[model samples]
Every structure is written in structure tokens, then in C-alpha cells.
Target: MSEKILFVFEGEKTEHVIARNFISHYIQKENKTVIKISFCGEIYQLYKKMSEDDFGIEFVDLFPLLQERDENLKKYKRDDFSQIYLFFDYDPHATNASNSILNELLDVFCQETEKGKLFVSYPMVESIRCYNGIEDNFMDLLINIDEVAYFKQTVNSYAHKKYNNVPQWTINIWSEVIDLHCRKANLIVHSKNDFPEREVPQDLILTKQIEHENKSNNVIVISAFPLMLLSHYGEKTASILQNLA
Candidate 1:
């Protein structure tokens, strides 16, 4: 059997679109690996689903009884996947319930860092679009506008609208968009490794390490997903991000 890689995302919109497109392109070229993508609404929902499916306990029930439950669940080890990634964003405006949910999810992911990896985009998933080395400029353009509003107006809406217009928006078109915007800013888009990192929890294992100049700069940290693809597939991943305009 081929090596199975699973990606679970936080939503069905942009995250799903990017993950699905990247996985589809990746598997077509890489016959040795099988990729599967799933969306479970949010980070907490993903934790809840994984816990119940893999350990037979809800997130709430797992914490207090973790010692006993972990011992029992060891016998039911889930070793089918070669790699499992959870894609989420660190939204500053998240609800109280969502914040609490992410705290629990972070706790569980920290414990299973070897088996489960979390790829969190700071601010929002739109950060991935901003990863083309022009983030500072792009963010500056959004200074007067909210990030979500800018994303919806620029990246998200543009993709969907273009998709509708053509009946099929190929990966080449996606590449064109990236190249056009990145080149316009005189930016040389690099891979995930080149991006700067913001501080996360000390206990959390970030797959890729990056540094920030200061506390106030808007930084995009992609710990897995696209970075994993880039590491394994190289230029193919970059091709998907953008090509020369």
C-alpha cells in the first residue's frame, strides 16, 4: 500500500479549496503517496472528532480521565496514516467557545506531536495567499481594510469569480495570479522555510522554525501542509503557488 497522508482542515471554504487543489495536483505526480483531505468545521471540532474516533471519548471527557483513557486507548492504536495534519488559523476575533476549544485542541496536539501535526496560519487562512514574500506590502494595503474583508474582496472572491467565468480555473491561472501580484511588488516569493515565525506556545512542536523581527510585525508561519509538500515535491509545490506573469 502507498503511504497515506491525511489533512484535516478547519473549514469548507478557502482552506478546503487550497488543500483540495494542492492534494489533487500532488497525488497526480506522486504515485507513491496517497493523500486524503477532510474538513471538520473548526479546530475544536477536529479535536472532538479525532478523540471520539480514535479514543472513544469526547474532548471534555478526555482531560480529567486522560491517564486511564490513554492507557486503554493504547491498545487501539491508530497507525494507518504515515502523517496527519490539522490546518487551522489563529483568528484574533474568535468566539469565547472557539477560544476554549482551541486551547483543548492545542493541549491534545502537543501531546501527539509525533503522530499529529498542526499547521496554523496566524491571523487567518488568507495568510497563505500572503506567503509570497509581499506580505508586508499586502498587509499594508489592508491597513484601512479588515483582513477578512480584504481577503474576501481580493483573493477569495477573485478565485471564485474567475472559476465561474472560465467554467474551469486551472492551476496555471492560480500561478498567474500569484506571479502578477508578487512581481508587482518586486517580491521574490520563496518557500515556507523563508517566512518568519511568530511566537507560539513553548511546549508546542513547530515543524518549521522561523523568526520575527519584532512583536508587532504581521508574520505568516506555515508549519506543515504546503511546507511538507514543498519538502517532498519541491518545485511542483512552487508551481502551484504561482508562475511568472
Candidate 2:
């Protein structure tokens, strides 16, 4: 039996890199654990990757509901796992349908858990752009998460007209974003003892073991963004799940 997680993403070019990196790191570093990944919503290439990769993790890039339904139909039902982790960005929409999707997933996981299903969920977290640390002289560090036009305008005004390559700007900006994302994830997983008390479920029974096996999984949600956090600890998270099972 292997541990699994459902990886949900917006599936942009940047996101694709993150997913691949996560899978690569986990598979190489942690042999004890197994990951089953699935992608959903407005994505195509990820489905291609999922098909091409021989890794054990499942990947699907369809509507979230359909993806979950497919997982349920598989040999591993919703109750078969130890945890279900949802990853998504906040979208500006009238209905905020992401929450609805998340809730449905939780409902299924919870239903199965109550029926002696071992799975649990950590819901209602998001990944958005924060300041990437490339502040000084780094004209390429464009903030692409939100306010895209504004971010580009700022980049254009950096007074460095000599460098006009779009790819350079994208790379620089993405690198900074990726680095910040990794830093945040590290802090969250590393700082379990210092987290402020909350009324909501702050930790799960699975947390301790997951931390022991893969310390990065315990970090705050931000670090997991752009999938760097997962790539760093994917195997470890899987190992913990496998060990627990």
C-alpha cells in the first residue's frame, strides 16, 4: 500500500515546471513512499506529462470533480489514503467556485473517513504573489501572480532599456517567485512548534509522522506554492504515508 495526494493546480507553464520538479525530487530521494497525483482545471500539458511519466503518481488535467470521481473509481477509493491535500490559487469570480470544489472533495474524504476511511484534509489555503527577493537591480523579477499589467509596467520602467529580452524577464521574475515560494514552505514545515494557536484544526495526527519522514510537508502552505515545496518533500510525504499504512 502507498500513500497518495491529489495535486490540483491552474496548470500554467510555470506550474508545469513545479509539478515536474516535485515528482522528480520525490522519486529520486524517497524510495519508501509513493505519490498518486492528479491535475485539474484548464490544463492540457500536465495530462501529457502524466501519461508519459512512469512515476506512480497519477496526473489528470480535467475538471476537479471528474478527476476526483475517476480516483474514486480506481482501485484506491477515497477512504484508502491517509491525507488529501488540495492546491489551488484564488480566482476572482463571482461564485468563488474553488471553495465549492474543495468542500466537495472534503465531504467525500470525510464521509469515507467516518466510515473508517483513514484520510484527512487540510483545506482553505491559497498561493498568491508576494514580493520575490530580487528587489535590487533585478529588472526581470516581474510579479506575475496578480496585477499582471501593473507588474509589467513596473518592469518596463526599471530604466534598463539595454536588456529587451522577454524570456530573460520571465525567467528572472519566475526564479524569484519560485525561491520565495520555497522559503515560505520551509518555514511552515519547520515551524510547527511556533504556529499561533487557532480554533481550526492546526495539526493532524498524520503531521508528526509526516514531519519526521519529510520535514517540508509540515510547513505553511506558501512554501508549497509553484510546487517547489512538494518537489522537495514529495517522496518524504509519500514515505510517511506508506510508513503509517
Candidate 3:
């Protein structure tokens, strides 16, 4: 049987393009069939909808949302996917943004075998390119609420040229980037400076981000897609990225 994987994303453009390339380059070889859908809104909106009185704690029926937003997903049942993943931005600047809501959503959806696994990009998705070099301190790239609106341009201007555009990135580029982001995530979760050896729970990353934001009113820049790779592919993802194109 073909293993089906579902990606529910926040944006219709960049997030979709980046993730498709990463999965196509890295995971599809394992015979996983991929399906992509866009939530078409910020994370807070999904929380409000999910927390509505009718939805309750059962809070897990994304196929309906996917079918409503994308014509292609309508025919597929929830059971069709062997694994499901969600990518959304931690747009704390958003009007409805609340740490509590985000925390609840993260806790609820923490398992891929169950509800789904979620990875959050700080401020926005452009964070994937927020790295400048292998040796540079990526944690230095933090954004306050004021900078959130202009972060895409900021990353475009300051990120390493090799990682600036989706079209220009080869499988080689994908592996290199996957290596960078996963290592950066390890720094956030475990205070480690090496590649992750185990899963870093999404809720823990959020807790770390919240602590930083509370102290400085700025979130450390990070991307969702690359971190998602760590969970989906596990520790081998770091080592495989070291060896792959």
C-alpha cells in the first residue's frame, strides 16, 4: 500500500512550494504519497474555529476544512492519509493571537499518529531563509511584533543568497537547509548546539519561544517545514541530510 501523507499549510504559495520540494527531495523516495492543502489564514483563526462551542475537545476534523478550501481534497476520506502534518506561522502580531490558544492547539495536536503533528514558524514562513551561514548564530535573528509585517523582505535582504528562493534550491540545497534548521531547533529545545538526536516536542519549542517573547517581546526566528522534517523522518533525518543531495 502507498503511504499517504497530508500537509495542511497556512499559505497557498511559499509554504506549499518549500514543503513540496523538501518532501519530494527527501521523503517521497520512501514511497509516501503527498497531499497538500492550504488553511488560507493565520493560526489564530483556526484556533477560534476549533474552539467554538460545537467543535469542543474532539478538535480533529481537518479534512472538512481542507475539502472546503481546496477542490482536490474533497474526494479523499480522512482515513486515506497514514500521516498528517500542519505548518502554521506564529504570527503573535495577529489581532487574535494568544499564547494560551496556541499552547492548547499544540498540546492537542502533538502526535502525528493521532490528530497530527504541528510545526510553527516564528513570525512567518520566510523564517526558513533566516539563516545566513553555517557558523552564524541563528538565534540572533529575532523579530519583534513590529517587524513581523516586513520579515519576508528582511529575510530576503539578509539571508544567505543560496537559500533565498524556492526555485533556485536544488535537492543539494534542500539537504543543506534541512541540516541547518534542524540544528537550530535543537538549540531552542535542548540548549544543544548539534543536530537533534530525538524529537523536540512542538509544545516545548512554543514554551521556549514564549519565554523569549515575554522577556524581550521578540521571537527567535525559525521555520516550520524544516522542523517538521525532524519529526516525520526522526534522528535519521539529520544524518540522512548529511549524506543526501
Best model per TM-score: 3
In model 3, how large is the Cα lDDT of residue 125?
Answer: 87
Better of 2 and 3 by lDDT: 3
> Against the true structure, whose lDDT is highest?
3
Tell me the tens digit of each residue's lDDT in model 1 across 1-245: 56655555566556666655556655544544443344535554555555666553233432222223234223322465555566776553444225445555655654322445455554456644543334344433321213433543454443334433221446665454333333322221233223222222312322111222123333333223434443344444445464321
In model 2, what are the clashing residue pairs, if there are any? 22-231, 37-58, 39-60, 185-223, 188-219, 188-220, 189-218, 189-219
Candidate 1 Cα errors over 4 Å, as ranges: 32-39, 44-77, 97-113, 126-136, 139-225, 231-245
What local distance difference test score does each model get? 0.43, 0.34, 0.81
Model 3: per-residue Cα lDDT at residue 16: 76
Tens digit of per-residue lDDT, candidate 2, span 1-245: 44444444443344444444444433324432433343444222222333454652132322344345345325544444444443443331213323334333323333211321111211112122323233332211222323432433443454244332323434344444444443333334454322122211213322432343253322122323433233334434333323422
User: At residue 184, what lDDT does model 1 achieve?
Assistant: 24
Clashing pairs in 3: 172-245
Cα-based lDDT at residue 5, candidate 1: 57
> 111, model 3: CA deviation in Å?
1.6
lDDT of 3 by residue, 1-245 (tens): 87998888898998877776777777788888998888898888887767664858456576686688778788798899888898999988788889998898888878787788788988788888777875566755678878888887888888888778876789887777777777777887887878887777788888889888889888888888878888877868766786776
Predicted structure 3, TM vs. truth: 0.94
